[model samples]
Target: FWESLLMQLLLFRESLLIHLLLFRESLLIKLLLFWESLLMQLLLFRESLLIHLLLFRESLLIQILLFRENLLMQLLFFRESLLTQLLLFRESLLTQLLLFRESLLIQLLLFRESLLIQLLLFWESLLIQLLLFRE
Candidate 1:
């Protein structure tokens, strides 16, 4: 009976060591898998950040193109309006010049008619005086 009890105690000690070793191996594996998952999450976050930066660059390019187009359109409109104003001013100047020319011509014609009437009256008076002296 003493030898049997000693053998049973030895077997129980061997089983407990085996159970402890298995539990330690399982815990190590759990820690390794957790670290691997954390590393994968960090890589995924970096990739997402890179994608967002690329998208932001593309949007910046689009905004620059739109601004350039708008600036070009504004320049074109300004040029057209400037040309229109110039043409209108030229037309007004020409009309004013023509009106001034017409007014000067009318004054010259009226002055010429008055000078002719004065010359005719002077000739008639001279003829009447000469006829009275002959009588």
Candidate 2:
């Protein structure tokens, strides 16, 4: 019975770890997709602005230059922010995984201790029984 329970606990732990891994992967993919979409949008906006400037001549050139500079600044800020978020998320995931591993180790140790106690109890009972039979 204890063995069966232990097996179930192990299986549960494996499944939980697998789920956490999948969740972490999905989060990373989502962040990557978000960053990619932002880049694509920036490129499209820049191309549209360039086309407008070409059609309008010098009048629009000044505005286009300013807009481009501002856009670049914004992009730089956004990229930095995204990078920071990614690093933070990665660190959080690592911490969670480490904690889960520690918990699993603790649980396993407890299971082992319980099994040892059971074995000792069984031995003591057997010794008592033998003495009674001899009497």
Candidate 3:
């Protein structure tokens, strides 16, 4: 009976050592899986950041193009407005010159009429003096 009990105790110790080794191996596998999951998460984050950077660059380019177009449109509008003002100024100057010409023509006509009336009065007075001398 003593020999049998000793054999059973040795067998039990060996089985317990094997169980401990399996538990340690399972723990190592769990740790390795957790590290792999963390690496995958990091890679995904890096990819997301790169995508965002590309999008921002594209947006910046579009904004620059829009601003240039707006500036060109404004310049065109200014040119058109300046041309219109110049035309209006030219028309106004022409109108003033025409009015001055009309006034000069009217003044010349009035002077001519006054000279004709003075000549007629001189002829009539001369005729009356002749008739009195004959009588």
Candidate 4:
């Protein structure tokens, strides 16, 4: 009877060890599956974010173009008004005055155009920095 009890105890210990090892393996498999799912979700979220960023950039580009067009139109209208002034003063004794005003206006407009170009360049650099930061 003593020998039989010792054999049963040994068998029980072996079965318990097997069960523990199998349980550990199953847990590891579940953990791996969970990690894979999380990684896939992260990738999908990143792709969606990229799409949104592209759309936002497109809209901003369009708005900047429209702003540039509006500025150009305003500049053209100003030029036309200057021409009208020139024609009106052409036959008068104020030729020197007219020339001085015309030259000054042209210089001012050129300065404004340079300033706008600088501002646009600033915006473009800022946008590129933002995009780089995201990556």
Best by TM-score: 1
Which wins on lDDT, candidate 2 or candidate 3? 2
Q: Give a tens-digit lDDT track for model 3, residues 1-135.
A: 988898888888888888888888998999999999999999999999999999999999999999999999999999999999999999999899899888888888887777777777777777888888789
The residue pairs that clash in candidate 2, if any, are: none
Q: What lDDT, from 0 to 1, does candidate 3 have?
A: 0.88
Compute the lDDT for candidate 1.
0.92
Instruction: State how far residue 118 of model 1 sits from its true place (Å).
Output: 3.9
lDDT (tens digit, per residue) of candidate 4 on 20-131: 9999999999999999999999999999999999999999999999999999999999999998888887756477888889999999999999999999999999999999
**Stretches of candidate 4 exceeding 4 Å from the true structure:** 91-135
What TM-score, computed on C-alpha atoms, does each candidate reach? 0.64, 0.53, 0.54, 0.57
Of the two candidates 2 and 4, the one with more favorable TM-score, higher being better, is 4
C-alpha lDDT values of all predictions: 0.92, 0.95, 0.88, 0.93
lDDT of 4 at 123: 96
lDDT of 3 at 34: 91
Q: How much does each candidate deviate from the true structure in C-alpha RMSD?
A: 3.7, 51.2, 4.8, 35.5
For residue 95, give model 1's deviation from the true position in Å: 2.8
The Cα error of candidate 3 at residue 122, in Å, is 11
Q: 20-124, model 2: which lDDT tens digit per residue?
A: 999999999999999999999999999999988787887678889999999999999999999999999999999999999999999999999999999999999
